[model samples]
Every structure is written in C-alpha cells, then in structure tokens.
Target: MENMRSENHRGAAMEGVKLASEAAANTNRRALRDIKNILGAPHQPQAVSKRGLQEKPAAAGAKSQPSAVGHRPVTRKFAAILQQTQPANAPLAPIGSERQKRNADTAFNAPSDMECSKASDDDLDEMMTNELKEIDMEDTEEEEEEMPDIDSCDVGNSLAVVEYVDEIYSFYRRTEELSCVSPTYMAHQSDINEKMRGILIDWLIEVHYKLELLGETLFLTVNIIDRYLARENVARKKLQLVGVTAMLLACKYEEVSVPVVEDLILICDRAYSREDILDMERTIVDRLEFNMSVPTPYCFMRRFLKAAGSDKKLELLSFFLIELSLVDYKMLKFQPSMLAAAAIYTAQCTLNGCVSWSKCCELHTKYSEEQLMDCSRMMVELHRGAARGKLTGVHRKYSTFKYGCAAKSEPAAFLLDARRA
Candidate 1:
C-alpha cells in the first residue's frame, strides 16, 4: 500500500484519467494484499459450493451422493477466480511510482450475476472485523477519559505508574493476611522476649537513620526480622546477629548501596565477626525460604495518606506513629493495613481535634472509624509513650527537623477517652 502512493487527492491533479487510474491502482493493491494474506495462512478450506460436484454423480447413473467434494483446492480455486476477474476488466497499465504490472487502470464492464454470486464470505468477515475493532477502540478511549486518575503530584514521574496502581494495592489488601505472623508467636520463643525484640528494633531504627537509607528499606528490614524470628528460635546471643543480617538482606533487596559486614559489625562494637554474620545470613535465608517480598505498614501508609488528601504535617505524623508501632510487639495483632489505617486515623484526630475519617479514606482503606478504634487507641498510647520510652529511638529520629518534628505533636488523647469509658 505504501508503494502504491500517488498524487490523487482532491486538487492534487487536474487530469481525469490520472485520478481514475489512481483509484483503480489502489483497489488492485488492496485486493492483491488480501489474496497474499489468505494464501500464506494454513489449513483453510475453499468457499465453493457442492452443487457442481453433485451433478457429476447424478449424470453418471449413481443413485447415492459421493462421500467427497470436487477436486478444487483453496489456492487453485482462488487463483482461477482472480485470473478470470482480471481478464474481464481490461489490460493492466502502470499507475504508481513502483508499478509491478498489478495496475487495473482501464474502465470495467459491470459484473454479471454469476460474477457477483462468486464473492467469498471472507470479504464480509474482514469488513465486520474492521468495524468491530474501530468501535471497541472508540469505547476504550472514552472510558479512559471518563475515569478519574488518583495519584500524587508525581504522576509526571514515570516510576509512579498510574495504570494498575489500584489493582496493585487491591492485591496488597487481599494478600496482606499471608504476610502477617501469629500475634502471639513470641510465646513460643525460647531466647528472645518481646522486650528484647523491641530493643533490637530500636537499635536498628538508629542504624537505619544513620545509614541514610530509604523509608521503604527500613520497613522491609523490620518485616524480614519478624518473619525470621517467627519461624526459627534464635539464641539470646544470636538475636542481634539476626537483626543485623536481616537489615543487610533488606538493603540488598531495596537499596542501591548496602552497608558491608564490617560496618554492621563495627556498629555492634565487634561483637560478631564476618564469618558469624555470613553464617547468620545463610541461616536466615534457609529458615525463611528466601520469601522476602511482603507488604508492610509503609505500603498502606502512603496509600491512606493519599486517600486523605493530607498535608505535609499529617503525612509526617502518620509515618511517625506507624514507625512507633513497628517497635512495639503488641501492634502485631493488627495486619499491616489495619496498623496503617489506624495511624492515619489517630494522626487526623490529633491534628484536627475531631474525627476526620472521610468516606474516601474508608473506601480505600477498607476500614471505618469504629472498626479502627481498637488499633487507633493502641497507636495513641504508643504515641504518648514515645517521647519518654526506652524505645525512644523512633521518637528522637522523628523529632529531628528533617521529619518536621512529627514526634513533638501532641498524642491523640481523645481516642483513649473512649477506651476508658
């Protein structure tokens, strides 16, 4: 078709013969393309009727129908039909730049009844398919224009893909349950208690901040720790080894530059050597079967914050609370989604001094104010204790100017009032 280019648009040429030749040339090009396409395909049957074959058996004095059709194959029948049609029109003439003798440029006689009856059903099928494709494309374009796009100002960033974001989060919501460990899994541990686990996390929080890692890397680190501990029993001495090894694995998974074994060992004041760390890494990988991609509160935190149409302060405070919950073992009772939703709810109550769980938040988070009350109350308590608690690593980290002093914000005491009543 591209090779059939000709100057035949309106006012492109004044000669009537040139226009007629151009039209005939385009039609011939289209027909040849269709014929070549059909011939290239496999296992196609001819569209001929059985009427001609039946007459042969009748005239030969055979009383029964033959089990087979006539001897015309698909390619032979198509070639014969096209050849007959070409001679019926006129002698071919060159019309376009690259004319290869396929130009039907002369005037044609009207088709006979037999000629029109010979039209194959393939032409009708092609026309219907083209029309349906056009209609479907138009409908999809309209639907895209009508649907609302929800994302941060970073939609311009190619990494923040708008398409499939909702589906991704919806899948996160459904499978979040599998990511959670038993709330009371600490009871079966022989060496580490919840308090010791909290201390390990507090130290890790400090290490994470000092390393200047991404927020997601921090969350993934904690998830790796909890999941490893849930499946295996570590000795009291090896517990810190687990924390360091988990953080190392998480950095490999989430960061471009990970801390080396020497840096981690130095942080622990050379308590463990390189071989111990390497051995611990191997043990953790084997115990957990290398399943590290799990959703955490940070995943839901970003999403619920977006749904709330939150300002910078609300975002910080929400993150501050969720990080605090990360240090406390009691928060394990709630799924990552619930913990995230409650953090936002508690943050909203603290900042606005009233219930501000909007319909959009509820719809996206799949939780209402009432349903989040228990978790919200727990988060509020963690907030109250953050400034003065032994696990004040999260508080001191958030209180810095970089975090906008999110830790200094007053706790949502109003949520605790309902619990007391």
Candidate 2:
C-alpha cells in the first residue's frame, strides 16, 4: 500500500509540471499576439493602399499636416520595421502616392493643438512660389520703367550708348578730377612761352588736318602736351619733340593704326631722332603718371552742341571758341566743361542777341547765366581776337562756309557789354 501511494504522488507531480509548462507557453503566445497587434499583421503581405499604410490610427483631434520645410522625427524601431517589411530590390512607391501617405501620417501623428489643417506643406510651397513670382514680376516692371528702353530708341543713337551707358558715365564722371591742370603750372617754366605754346597748338591743328586723324587724336594730343608741361620742364629746343611725341602717344591710344615713329620724326623735320622721341615719350608719360585720361573742352563741346539742338551755326561758333580756348594760357583756369558751356553761351547770344541763358541751355548744360558770365566774357574776347585775325588757325579753319563762318561773324557790342556785366 505504501508503494502504490508513492507512485500516485509522483504521477500527480508530473501532471502539475506539464500543466505549468502549458500555461507558460500560452502566456508567451498571448504576448506575441499583443505584439503582432501593436505592430500590425506580419506576413507575406500585399502592398498597402496609401490611405491605410499606418500601423495604428492617430489620437483624436490631432493636426492634419506636417511642417512645410523640415522633416518629422522618426524613431529607430520604426525605421527597422520599415527596412524589414520592404525587400531591398522591391520597386519604390510612386512619388505622388508616397507623398500622400507621408502627408496623412504627418497629419495623424501631429500634436492635436497644432494648426496642421491650415495648409499642407505642398500647398504652402506652391503658394509661396506663386507669391515670389509675382514679386519678381513687379520688380522687373519697376526696373523696366526706371531704365530707358534701349530697343525703342533710334538704333544709331542707342545701340552702343545703351549697351555701355553705365561704364561710359562712370568714366566721364571723373573728368573734372582727371582733367584738372593748375593754371600756375606754367609760372615756373623758363624756355616755353605762351606765344610758343599757341604756335605749337596751331601747327598741331594743321598736322591733324593733314593726317586726317580722328578728332579724338587731336584732342588727346593736346591733353597729353598740356599735362606733360604741367609736370615737366622741357627746353625750348625739345618743345617740338615733346609735341610730336605727345601726338604719337595720343595716336597709339586713340587710333586703329598708329602713326609710324619714322613718320613722326619726318614731321618734325628730323629735329628729333627716334631715340630722343622715344626717350622723351617715356619721360613725359612717366612724369604725368601715365594718367592720359584728361578730358578736353571738345568732349564737352559735342555734348553742349547736341544740347543746343545741334544748330549748324551755333555748333561752328562753339567749336571755334573752344579751339581758341585751347591756344590761350589764360583760359586754363576754367574747367573743360565750363569752357564748353561758356563757348556755347557766347555763341547762342551772338546768334540770337539774347542777354539771358536760354531754357534749353540751362536744362542741358546745367549752368546759369551768372555762372557763365566770366567765361563767356573771355570767350567773346577770343572770338573778337579771331575775327581780327590775331587767332589765325581757328579763324582760318572757320572762315569757310562749311563751318558756317561763325568765327568771322561778330556779336553785337551790347552782347559784349553783357558778358562784362
């Protein structure tokens, strides 16, 4: 009986052990089921519709969109699940469908109090793009209005000018500073006299005419000579060499085909050897600091003539006056623009017998009658001197009808008196 009871006890113990093992297995299976529920069904699953891709529904009253520019934060476990679910070689989801799914996910996962419903990121992006386009269009319109329309203007006038307007204006705006030559610069000179300077200028004009060089070449030659004199002391004998060398430098800077050094030597009757000319050229250029950008009265004369409506008579008279200014040392005190304006003013009054500055003159030249009086008086004196044949080169050049002979034409005595007044 004792043996049978021991056997029953052992059998009952074995049965209890089996029941505990089963219970443990059941608990493990229940936990696995809860995990599966949390993560959604794991299987050889079909591709999900974009609308139903999320593992779980978001909490109620959550925002419906994500931030526009930045991305949402994702946890590592979620990324791992994504990596495991999608095969490495599988075709990607269509971009539109993927974006829609991401939008829905972002909206569902967003904080409830946030304003996700205001606009989707894509919608906001499109709206911002349109706003930026409108702003750019407005700016373009304003710019078009502010800047002159080069296309509509005359081709001859506008093409080159409009293309390089900014560069040209920047260059010419420094004219006063670049062209300033001290009136007293010649006071210390020993060998060079004002009469000799005038003669040199007259000869240069003749050479300019003979060579058929551009007006710019003549203007630049004169500029170089005056600037060199301002800085250097050339002996009386080397003066012609200086003039010829200055012309050569000017030709090189302004001409398409520069005059030959041999030709320049011949022009001066071989008074200067090629070596002497070249040596002086370097010396003059060095002393002037290679600042050959002096603005001449001729540059301003052209603008002033155009401002005065390009009157044939007035243009000739103004040209004659400006050229006369070039030969006179006394006229060096005035700026190039001032000389041009004064020339124009004197010419206009001589032609029209007007005492006051014309509106066109004031509008274009930006000078008042009072400001121009002194220079005008000086110009009137030069014109009279030319008329009397004292200033012969300019007088002879304008004596022809081609130049309207305005140099020979005299302003009334009252106009001369007004210049003095």
Candidate 3:
C-alpha cells in the first residue's frame, strides 16, 4: 500500500507539472498576439491554428494508452471542437513531420551572424558611393546655375574687356619719351646742376603743399619740369629759376588761379628775384614751344582703373602713387600715363590681397599681371634709388617757407597765396 501510494503521488506531481507548462505556453501565445496587434499586422487565424496543431502531438504522445480506446466519445468531442475553431487556410500537415522538415530547411539556408555582418559592410560601402555621386551631381548643377548666360543683355560690350590691352599698349608708346631722360642722365650732371635740380624739386614740393593742390598738380608740375629739362640743357644756378617758372606755368595751366610773380619770389624765401623769374619764364615758354599740352598721371590712372573695373579703388592708390612720386625723380621721367597705370595696378593687387600670379591675371585681363608686377618693381626700385637723401631737402625748404615767410600772414591770406602760388 505504501509503494502504491508513493507511485500515485508521483503521477499527480507529473500531471501538475504538465498543466503548468501548458498554462505558460498559452500565456506566451497571448503575448505574441498582443504584440502583433500593436504592430498592425493583419489577423492570422490560420497561423494561430497551425501553431495550436503543432503543440497537440506532444500532449497526445505523453499518454501511454491510445485515447481512441478508452475515451472515444471524448476524443470525438475534441475533434469537433478543433474543426469548429480551425481557420480555413490552415495547412493539412502532420504536426511533428512538417515541423522537423521546416527546421532542417532553416538550418541549411539561413545566414550566420558573421555572414550578415559582412553583407552589411558591403551594403554600407555601396550606399556611401551612391551618396558621393549625388553630391557631385549637386555641385555640377550649382555651377551651371551660377554661370552667366552669354545671351544676357547686361553683359554689354565684350570688346570693352579686350580694348584695355590696346589702351595699355598705346599708353606705353606715348610714355616712351621717358626712357630718354633716364636716371643716368640726371646722375651725370655737374654738381651745380644737381644742386639746382634738388632745390627746384624742393620748391615744387613746397608749392604743392602750400597750395594744397594735392598730388595731381604736383605731378603735372613735375612733368613740366622734366619735359623742359629733356628739351633744354639749363645750368644748375638757374635750377631754382626753372622750378619757379615751371610752377608758375603749372599754376596757370592746372590750378584755379596763377600765383603772382611777387608771391612766387616770396615763396622762394627771396632766393628768386622777380626779374630773374620773369626772364626764366620767357625762356621756358620759348623752349616748350608754348605747347603746354602735357599728359598727367591722373589721366592714365583713371583710364586704367576703368579698364580694370576698379574705379572705386582709386583714392588709396592715387595717394600712394602720389607719395611715391615724391620719392623718385626717375618716376617723373616715366610718362605720367605708364606710372599712373602701373601704380593703379600695384595698389589694386595690394589692396585686394592677392599673392599669386594667376589671381592678379584673373583680376585684370589686359596686360598680364606679370607685366604689371614687373613694371611696378622697376618703378619702385627706381624711386628708392632716386629718392635717397631727398626727404631732408624737401623738409628744409618747406619748413623755411612755412615758418619764415608765411607765418605772419592770415590763415586765409596764406591759403589764398599758397593756392595762387
């Protein structure tokens, strides 16, 4: 009896374990259904019926006796319930056999995790290449959009762009006269002529500052002085004489009103007599052949700036070029036209902050930026050499004139006299 009771207790424990397992499986099925509903998957009653059918064989096989023998009616009732609940699309397959076949197929065909990772890497490489190709296409489209249409009306006068080349060439030819009055010519002169030249330049610069005529008048006066020197071989003693006369001529030609002979002499610190100035003036008028039609640096500067499409950049360049003129008498020998153009080009390059050769060429299509660079270098070198020791001369003369002669006069009187002078 004890052994039989022990065996019954064991059977009861196994039955309870089986019931618990079935209950857990049912809960897992319900959770899966809820997840499918949340994901918006269509209701798959046929799949559910198939899953139920798969679980049944294990339950039936656990029983040792054939259920058809002892529970025929119960078995029939179970079959009727199954038929009623089963979905129409459920496959007619023996549960254990079909599941085993499916497992075998999955083991043969499915990729391992390592294989999947390599496929992902290949997919990423392909995606990156395609993305790069799209970016290139976008860049091409943007370039096409930014390009100006040749047919547009606003592009006006294609020839204007090319015309500057000829203009630069023509200006170069016009200023060829400068090459004749080289620095060597000035260097070879006697001490007296050199001293007179120095004195003359000093007076010219003084007149320029006093008159407040700015660099334009100063440039014109210097050109007149150089041209006169080019034509006549005046002595050094007469250098002041030539300078005053040339300034008088420039004042009349370039300024609003010409300074009187008395004013010119006074500005000279009484170094020049009225009679001496008058005589020198006559000589200059005759030597120049009374043809005072001299070209100025400003004229060329304007033209070149226009050609380079940089009229807006003129003020700074003009100031620098004018200051540079003060440093070099050799610059006077350069046709006002060439120096002006060259100065403008150099100033533009400096201001725009372009360092490379190609960038400057791109900015101004007319003379190669290389040619402009060479021209600027030559001008600066010539200026530095000629300008040596000249600033002191300029300062001494201006200081004497400004303090000694003009100090007693009214500010307005001084300004007027300076202007006329």
Candidate 4:
C-alpha cells in the first residue's frame, strides 16, 4: 500500500510540473507578441520544440502518459534566450543529431573575424561608390537647371558689369613708358618754326575732319610728326609731305576704316604722289625705330575726365584746351599725363566757374592744386593766344554745336589771368 501511494504522489508531482511549464511558456509568448507590436513588426507564432514532450495513450485509452521528469519543452524564443545566458561550457544542442553535427562543422570551418571584416569593407566601398554616383547625378541635374540660356538673353541692355580697369591702367602705363620724350629736344629745321608747325597742324586738323578719321588718329599723327622732327631735318617744301604721310600712317595705326593712299594724295591736291607718301611713311617709321606707340594727352584726358565725373560741356572745354595746346610747341615740354590733368583743372575752373581744383580731382589725378598751378596758367594763356591767332581749325571745330560750342565761351578774367607772370 505504501509503494502504491508513492507512485500516485510521483504522478501528481509530474502533473503539477507540466502545468507550471505550460503557464511559463504562455507568458513568454505574450511577452514576445508585445515586443513585436512595439517594434512595428508583424507577429509570427513561434514553433515550440516538443522533442521531449511526446504524448502516449495509457492502456485502454484511459489518459495521456506524462513526460519524463525534468524534461520541459521550450519555445524557439525561450530557447534563444536561454542559449545566450548559458555558460560557455554548457552544451546547447544534442551532439548526436545530424543538424547539430553540421552546425559544429560550419562553426569550426568558418572564416576568422579579420577575413569577415575585410569582406565587409569591400561591400561597404561598393555601396559608397553607388551612393556617390547617385549624388553626382543629382548635382549635374541642378547645374543644368541653373545655367542661363544664351539665345534668350538681352546682353546689350544688361546692367554694366565690373571691368578690369587695372588692365587698362597697365596698358596706358606701358605706353607712357615707351613714349617718353626728352624735354631738351629741339628740332634742327630752320624752316619748321613753331608758327609753321602750327599752320601744318591746323591743316592736319582740317584734313582729319574731312576724312572723318578718329580723334586718336589726329593725336597720333601729331605725335609722329613731332617725334620725327626732333630727330630729322627736312626742307619746308617736304614738311607738308611729311605731315601728309604721317597722317596716312596714323590712320593705318588707329583707324578702323583707314583712308586709301589715293584719297590722301587727292586731299593733298596731288601735292604728294602715292609713291612720295609711301616713301616718306617708310622713312619716318625707320627714323623712329618703329616706335609709333606714342602716348597722347587725349589718352590721359579720358582717364582724368572719368575721374572728374565730367559732363559733356566740361569734356568739350577740356578737349578744346588740349587742342589749343597742340598748336603750341612749348607745351611739348610737359608729359602727356600732366598736360591732361592741367587741361581738366583749367576746364573745371573756367566752365563750371569753380574757384580752384577740388579734392576729388587731386585724389584721382594725383596732382595737387599747387602742382597744376603753372601748367593750368600755361593752358589758359594758350587759349587766349589761340583766340587772337589766325590758326582757327581747332577754334572753328570747338565753336560748332558738335563740340557744344565750348570755344565760344570763355572763363572768368580773374580765373584765366590768375597767377600769370
């Protein structure tokens, strides 16, 4: 009776253990479901391993046989958790099964951590290359969208863009350096006095107008004549030929549509044949050593006018003053830049009724009021003399409406005669 009671007690203990195991598994399943919902993953029912929990029917189908003691089936999730927490020496799976044997072989033959890392780095490089290609494609599309269309643009009416004025300044500086004239230069020709020079220049101006050559061409013609006369002595008869040839060469140098040699011959009333003009042109070029890059007061006048913020009237007066200086041989003693600065200052004092040079003028021209005192006085005296003299080409040109009649107007007597010796 004691032995039978012991068997019933063991059976009851086994049933209680089975019920506890089922309850724990149910709790784990619920926890896993909660985790899946929190992670936004679809819930998947896990397979519960029943390796040791196979049920057998009792004799005559009375009841199910109990599983062996201490053997509780676990769900896949629970098995994973227990495996992670198990000691290194603990056996995870049965060694006798084919699946476990294959797993052991895979673990032993697998690549080392270093080898796996190298393979992962290669994969990462490939992925980065693909990502960079995608980024470059996006950048190219944005660049295409941002580009301006040339055909639809109105470049002429567009607001002025900043220019590299420094380059222009540099070019002018180089020209000045090359065109430097000796102040002590004196022409040797007895026939070519200052008065004769003035007459020739006046005729050149008329010719310049008749031909409609650029102002630059007239200035250059005078420069070539002066430079040549300084070095060469010529007969009074050939002086007119020299002037005509110089104009032809200057037109070639500066004019976009240069007058033909025949036109120049015609303008000279056939005084110089085409051959005579061509021969003199070659002689003048040879004597000057091909140094035709003579700087003119007009070059500096443009810069000074820009600096002074000159209007059309102020510019016209300044140009008139400069042209008057062209007839005076004494004005050649001053450099082109100084003549330009003095001309503008005199024009300002005369036309605008200003008493003296402004600080802005000094800042731009780099010439103080005192520095220009003598030069300005000389310009004023030249203007007064041109008014009384017979060479009226420049005077007639400036008296026209085209020059805003700048010559018809005169400066205040006090201003014109100021500091005159």
Candidate 5:
C-alpha cells in the first residue's frame, strides 16, 4: 500500500512540470507578437490613386466603393502600402509605375507641413530670379543710352574753337608791355634803319597786291616780321629774306589758301631762288619752332568792339585801322590792342571832324590807348621816315582798295584823300 501511494505522487509532480513549461512558451510568443504589431503598424498608411491620394472612407463601410468613379480601393491601398515601406530620404523615381509608387511613398511618408514649407522656399527663389532679371534689363537700357555715336565729331570741332580764342588772348597779353616803347630805343643807327624799313615796306606792298589777301592777315604777317627784327640784331641784307619768310609763316598759320614756296619766290621778283627760299624757310621754322601763334589787330578790334558795344562804329573803325596798318610798317611793332585802339580813335576823329578830349580819355580807358601811345608814336615815326620807293607795291594795292571804297561811300573817299594829303 505504501509503495503504490509513492508512485502516484511522482506521476502527479511530472505532469505539473510539463503544464508549467507549455504555459511559459505560450506567454513569450504572445508578448513578441504584441511588440511587432506596435512597431510595424504605429500609424495607418495613406491610400494613393493614379490621380492622387484617395479620400478616406467617411465611416467604416461608407465607401465600400472608391470615392472616384472606376477608382479601385485595392489599387490605392497597395500603393499606400508600397509608399509606407520606402525610406523617407529616397530620390523620386522616373515616371511610370515605379514613379507612381515613389510619388505615393513621398506623399504618405512626408509630413504635410514639411511639403508646405518647401513650396514657400521655391516661390521665394523664383521671385528673386525675376527681380534679378529686371535689374539686368534696366542696366542694358542705360548702357545703350550712354554710349556716344561716331557722328558727333562736330561737337568736338566746336569745342576746338575755344582753344583758338585762348591762343589769341595769350598772344595779345604778351606784346602789351612793348606798345609804349619808342623805335629809337629799338635801333642802333637811325639812317640805315629808315632805308632798310623802306625796302621792306615796298616788298610787302608788292606781295600784298599780288596775293589780294585780307588786310587782317597781312597786318599780322608784318607785325611778326617787325617784332622778330626788333628782338634780333639781324643784318640789313637779310631783312628782306626775314620778311618774306615771316610772311610765309604767317600765311601758313592764318590763311586758308596759303601760297607755295615757289609762288613766294616768284612774288619776290626772283630776288630769292627756290633753293634759297627753301633754306630760309627751314631756318625760320627751326627758329620759330612752329610757334607762329600771335594776336592780330583784327582780334583786338573784335574784343574792343564787344567792350564798346557798337557794331556799326566798330565796322567803320576796323576798315580804317586795317587800311592804316598797310601804310605804317611801324604799327607792326606795337601790341595788337594798342594798334586797334589807336585806329579806332583815328576813325572817330575822322568821322566827327573834331577833337573830343573827353571822348579820347574814355577810349583810352576802354583800350589802354594812353599806355600804348609810346609804341604807337614809335610805329608812326618808322612809317613816316620809310623810303617812298620801298612802298611801290603797297601803294598800288592800297590805291585799288581805296578806289573800291571810294565807289562805295563818300566818307570813305574823303578819308582816303585826307590820308594822302
């Protein structure tokens, strides 16, 4: 009886151990299944259709069919499942079933808020690009307007006129101080000076008659000749050569139709051969160094007339002064301003036929004529003492000019006759 009781107890104990092992295994399997479900299905996957995300069923079974006609729920659910399986950072796939799958994946996995933020950045970039394009267009237009055309060369030519005016003014100022000085101070021997001057005057007159150039140009050439001679103690024999050379230089500088070297030689009555004149021309050009810039009485006359504010009177004064300049080679040594003023004074006297001291004073003040009297007096004496034969050509030219004037006006004829007497 005791043995049978002990066997029963052993069997019961083994049975209890087997039941405990089975129960532990079942508990482990259930815990593992719960963990997998939580991690794999944390959120419901979004449905995708060919068009876009399919609308969710309003209530369970409210849309047993898809919201869109002919749209299948299984297709949308498969797309959503595929999208959910894809990695978040994967690049978009090419267009086709693969691209559709990728698009579905992007839509399902990507947050709505994140896509909205990226859209704002793309809009900002586009706006910036448009603004930069507008700025570039504006810059192009401004560049086109600012660029100058090649046809505007006339504007450059006009600007060059101011340079000429400045050059004339500078020449006037340089000779202003020498206007008052006497010719005796300028010469060592009076008798020889007189004879040489006469020869120079005669040669000048001949050239003037042949050229028929304006009086303004001739006066300028003569002034240059006298001024150069006064400054340099050149020999009396070289005086004619110097005069011709000076005239050539002046003509080249001032005249539009300049005479050639051959023409100048011929005009000098073959006194200078072509070779001789050419040699002299080279020497003068070298000495002057092409600096033939000098003011003429004509230039000063314009300035004085502008200051005086009388165009008609200025015209009359210019005619007489230019004519007188031809007769008196001494005037060449005077400053252009002094000669211009004196000529104007002389004309005024001739016109009114009276001596007005007050008017003379006003004129002197206006042109500094009183200051220039010494130079004017010296110039007058040089011409008065000049030999008569030297001025043969000059006389002929002046006679013709005077005759033309006489034909035009009684006042001019009377003035010419009075001047001869």
Candidate 6:
C-alpha cells in the first residue's frame, strides 16, 4: 500500500510540472503578441515547431495546451532571469545554464528584432534622401543668387549702352560667324605661308604701336588681311604692301586721327609710295565689299572686361595675352568672342595664381572654362615663348612700364598640368 502511494505522488508531481510549463508558454506568447503590436508589425499567431508536445491520457487532456509550444524553453529563460531579481535566498543560476537561457531568449526575440531593424533601416534611408534633396535645392538657389547682375551698375552711363548693349552683343555674336576665316586657309595660298603671315603680323604690331593707334585698328587690319587673303592670292612681294594697306584701311575705319598715307610710306622706310598704298586700299575695299563694320576680338574684350569687373592690372594682362595670340596663325581657328573670353580667363588665372571663373563671367561670356580651355591653352603657350622668340613685338610692348609690364607676369603653368592629366 505504501509503494502505491509513492507512485501516485510521483505522477502528481509530473502533472504539476507539465501544467506549469504550459502556463509559462502561454504567458510568453501573449508577451510576444504585445511586442509585435508595439513595433507596428501585423499580429501573427505563434507557430508550433516540428518538435511539438505529444498527446497524453484523456485525464491529462482535460487540461489546456498552450497556444504556442515553441516558447516553453523561452519561458524557462524568463523564469531564470526573474528569479535573479528576487532575494539571494535562491542559488545563483549556473554560468552554463545562464548561457543557455540567454540563447533561448534570443531565439524567441529574433523575428521581432529583425522586423524592428528593417523598419529602422528604411526610416534612416528615407531621412538621408530627404536631407540630400534639401542640400541640393539649397545649392541651386545659392548659385542663382550668386550670379551677378553686372549690367545694373552701368545703367547710368550712356557709353555703357545699357539699353542696347545686350542686343548689340547679340548682333556681334551672330555676325562673328561671317567674320571667321579658315585656320587652314594658309594651305590654299601660293606665295604666302604661315611663317610669313606671322612675320607680317609681327611687323604690323610694331607699326600699330609706333603710330599710337587704337587696339581695334590693329585687329581690323589683321581681319582685313586674313579675309582678303582667304579669298584672293597675292605674290610674296606684295604681302607687306597688303599688310600696310590693311592697316591704312583699319586706321580710316577705327581711328579718330587717321595716319596719312605718306606717314605709312615713311614708316615702311620708303618701301612703297603713296600710289602703291592708295591702289592696294581700293582693291581691298572693293574685294571685301566695304564690310568694315565686322566685330573684332577688341569688341568682345571691352564687353568681357566689364563683365569681369576688371581693374587696370587685369585689363593690361588680358590685352597682353590676346596680343600674343594675335601673332600665332593657328589662333585664327578661334572666334573673336572666344579669343576675348579666353584671354581674360587666362589672364585672371595668371594674376590670381589659380583657376578662377566666376559665375558672372560664365553667364555673360556664354562659354564655360571647358569651352575656353583649348583657346586658353594656346594663349598660355604663346605667353611662355613671348619673351624669347623673334616675334617678340607683343612681349616688348607689354613689358613697358606704361602698360604696367603685364608681360613680366609668370604664365599659368597649372593649365599645362591639366592637359597632361
């Protein structure tokens, strides 16, 4: 009889253990559901694992099974944690047991942890995108605001031509296409070549300086020579005559006090007489159809200088670089406006010791530094050789104290580095 009583007591203890385990699993399922709701995830029923509890006798079956069985190990982990907070009457959980408990707790919390992490990642990405957009918008607005209104200051000056300035430049830019000569036109000339052309220009520049003529007169003279030569061939003997006659015509068109034909004769060391210059002048006017109103780089230079808000130093330096380009036949490939813009840009870089293209310059010039680069590079190259070469007329002119010795300034070497890079 005593043996039967002991077996019943053991069975009762096993039944109590099963009931306690089931109660703990139910508590964990409820806790998990509450946590999912808090994290804003859709409520999902806890699923049973493959190692689920088996059926028991009908008497045991009267007791309710937990809605979730996977949480039984997790419930034990929680009990271990809770018992640690209680008074020190209970023995401390073994280190190995504590590790297992933590592992089970982590397994139970993994799904919600991942869901929470994914949601946090999405929020962070959205925040970053919005911040970037705001920064871009701010940058665009700053660029627009920073672009200067250069014309507004000139409104009070009549010579500034604030009313018709934009229209006039638009006209010049449009007509410049007609004024451009082929850089390859030298290939078609029989008696004259590129070297001879450079020599003639170098000589003419010296004459233009000696006469105290306007800069535009020199430019127009070269224009007349190139355009006339582009259309008609001449003997090598007549090339200097062509140069002087073109200068004479340019003087008449651009100068307030035109130099007399006899004066040009005297300057050429009696090379030709009044009849030779007068005769060549008529032939050129007739050939070019008296289109003396064509725009030159000088026209664009004044405009870009004003756009740059230049001082005397910048102005002199820019002129020096352009005059250097004038001696190079290859520079004919660039348009007048392009040459002007590049000259000023190269001058700015030379004076400032860095590449400095302001927003104001780009807007008025209608060409970026990239567009001006090839021309600017050629200008810088000419600047390097200006002081050493035979065609040093320009270098001598700018080196004078009257022109602020702009030619003495060092060339912008960084631009050459950009080419190699």
Top candidate on TM-score is 6
Which is superior by lDDT, 1 or 4? 1
lDDT of each: 0.81, 0.73, 0.56, 0.75, 0.56, 0.86
Candidate 2 structure quality by residue, lDDT tens digits, 1-421: 9999999999999999788779978886543223322123344234555443444334579765533223333434444555687678977644445656677567555543223433466579889999999999999987655532422444577554656654554466465657767887777689888778888998888787778788778878887888888878878998888898999999988899888999888888878788998899899888888877767776767766665665677788877888888888888888877888888888877887777465665655668988888888877777777756444877787787867877678764565665457
Clashing pairs in 2: 64-107
Q: Which stretches in model 4 have alpha-carbon errors above 4 Å?
A: 1-163, 174-177
Per-residue lDDT tens digits for candidate 6, residues 1-421, read 9999999999999999788778878886443335432122235466544553333323444777443334243344445565666687865544445656676566655544445677799899999999999999999989777766678988899988898888999999999988899999989999889999999999999899888999999999999999999999988989999999999999889889998988888888899989999999999999999899999999999999988999999999999999888889999999999999999999999999999998788888899989999999889899999988689899999999999999999999999999999
RMSD, model 2, all Cα superposed?
Answer: 15.9
Give the top-scoring candidate (lDDT): 6
lDDT of 4 by residue, 69-131 (tens): 234434344356666776899644434456656754564456545556877998999999999
Write down the TM-score of every candidate.
Answer: 0.64, 0.60, 0.46, 0.59, 0.46, 0.66
lDDT of 1: 0.81
How large an RMSD does model 3 have?
21.3
Clashes of each: 0, 1, 1, 0, 5, 0
lDDT of 3 at 270: 93
Candidate 1 clash total? 0
Error of 4 at 52 (Å): 78
Indicate the worst ten consecutive residues by lDDT in candidate 2: 31-40
Which residue pairs in model 6 clash with each other? none
lDDT of 5 by residue, 297-402 (tens): 6766755544444446435544444454645545545556666765554444444554222332343234553554454344333333332434444334433554
Any runs in candidate 6 off by more than 4 Å, and if so which?
Answer: 1-146
